[model samples]
Target: MATFAMTRERIFRELVERSNRSGNAIWLARMIASWRVGEGALPDYLGLSPEQFNNLRSHCFSDIALPHLAVSGKTVDYSRMLEKQDLETLLGDFRAPDVAETEWIIAILVAGCLGSDHLWQDLGLWSRSELSGLMSHNFPELAARNNKDMKWKKFLYKQLCEMEGLNLCRAPSCQVCQDYGLCFASEESTSVIDQVERNFNRDA
Candidate 1:
């Protein structure tokens, strides 16, 4: 497992260095590198279709070919279920007016939300701050609405709930919410390898 992880890490470094054509190169590299390698494929886990992955590949790693990666059965057909029509509409409505050709980033983000981790970790971003950078640049309107610095995942769901007229949050306001920590806790993440090391040590 360690050896396999090292090879994936190598792939990440190479991709990060070579990916320069778009603003999302490092994002893609982190996601591809940190992806699981069992029972699923790369595109399956990232919530991208085979063609979408290929398009992203052409944009980021045009001359490179990634190894066949396996993903878990959990993510099979995930994009269809997670990519809800209303959710996409919500994100689409807030698409940065100044940024051109940002639909793909929205697709990636919607798919990424299906994961069980913090939004940034699920998207294979290095940290919450990195995810914030993407959001601020690509969906500045939505980003600006998060005046409380709430966790991205929490903020997104809150937005969705409000849009759909669903009062999911129990608190009257975020500041007084019983689940305040869950929504506003500090989010610090590291490289994929470093994350594994931390988990390994914790379990040791």
Candidate 2:
């Protein structure tokens, strides 16, 4: 397992390096890679049930595009939000620069533990700047080329589609789809994004 973990970390590091990320982007990617290796060991270390982790993971994704609505206060408490020390332990060698970064890491881990099986809905929790930082770290090459005016989610979806060779169209096929407006233009999505941004910034 240790050897496998090293190999995975090396692969992610090589990918990040090959992308030519620099400054905070490079640092963030390195930290994320290092932390990712400890994922399989998280349940044991945190004294968390793998089953319960999976259950929370389920609420992270949904075809309805309102996963956050599913996250009850009880669910948040049950998820056992990690403190700075717990994040440090799970992160191992990679040290987060501050509390915000640590919490960001925790959010990513929580999203992962809950399962990244669908298009990410929980990312709405992050503010514009926070999401921008993530784009820089996770998709440095794409992030560098993105037009500043582009919404982070749009940039992310575009990059993902390009990477996977997927042609995600919102014409005839997507127009009739339930999630059409969620990813594209819709009042609901705009409201949700605005609300989350306000909440995140206010808390910050």
Candidate 3:
């Protein structure tokens, strides 16, 4: 497994890099990074008071979603995607035994920020192997059965979008927008387009 310094900035940056490559995952990743890089209480990022945050966490962790993750032969449920309890446990599961308490908790909060959305279907926030790698690295026993699943991430993203009142739909004009290419461009193409736009604007 690859090991690196687990600084908040590092984790935030890692998620951001993931976002750059992810189609719809960009929004949640940006929100999570903003929360981490900002100077505020944890609840502030989610618009919850400390007490409410605690309450939510308590409610969530008490009954984890997808308890089948730890058991064998239990079928995974995709229909019940956006339960608050499941969303909470999505973050809670990141608190692996090997992770530092602070980092682990931050990981959970990051997951929370990711929340439920249909965009997740187009832009997978994390793939099955990525999740398996993370779990296997931190909690090997959980990886023994190796059921790599990421549908829960989509559910979590949907929930987050609902909580924030975010509209995840692409605009009808998105396909025709000049800036749409920025989202789909390769690094080199993006750079060339940036230069061209700068020159065009300068001449105008």
Quick one: best lDDT, which candidate? 1
Clashes per candidate, residues 3 or more apart or on different chains:
4, 1, 11
lDDT of 1 by residue, 61-141 (tens): 777876433454445354466536666898899888765436777777877676666788767666678888888888888
Regions of model 2 farther than 4 Å from truth: 1-126, 170-204
- Cα RMSD to the true fold for all candidates: 3.6, 17.1, 15.9
Candidate with better lDDT, 1 vs 3: 1
Candidate 3 per-residue lDDT over residues 26-145, each given as its tens digit? 333433333443211122314333454444334333232111111111122324534545445544554455443223333333434333322221122222333334444554553443
Question: Could you estimate the TM-score for every candidate?
Answer: 0.79, 0.29, 0.27
User: Which 10 consecutive residues of model 2 have the lowest summed lDDT?
Assistant: 61-70
The candidate 1 region of ten consecutive residues with least summed lDDT is: 36-45
Q: Write the per-residue lDDT of candidate 2 for residues 1-204, one digit (tens) a residue.
A: 346446646845564555423333343344333333332112221222454333322322112111222222222242453442443343433333442333334444444333231212233221245445654554445457665435444544454456557777655664477765554442233332344356568999
> What do the candidate models score in CA lDDT, each in turn?
0.70, 0.39, 0.37
TM-score of 2: 0.29
User: Evaluated with TM-score, which candidate comes out highest?
Assistant: 1
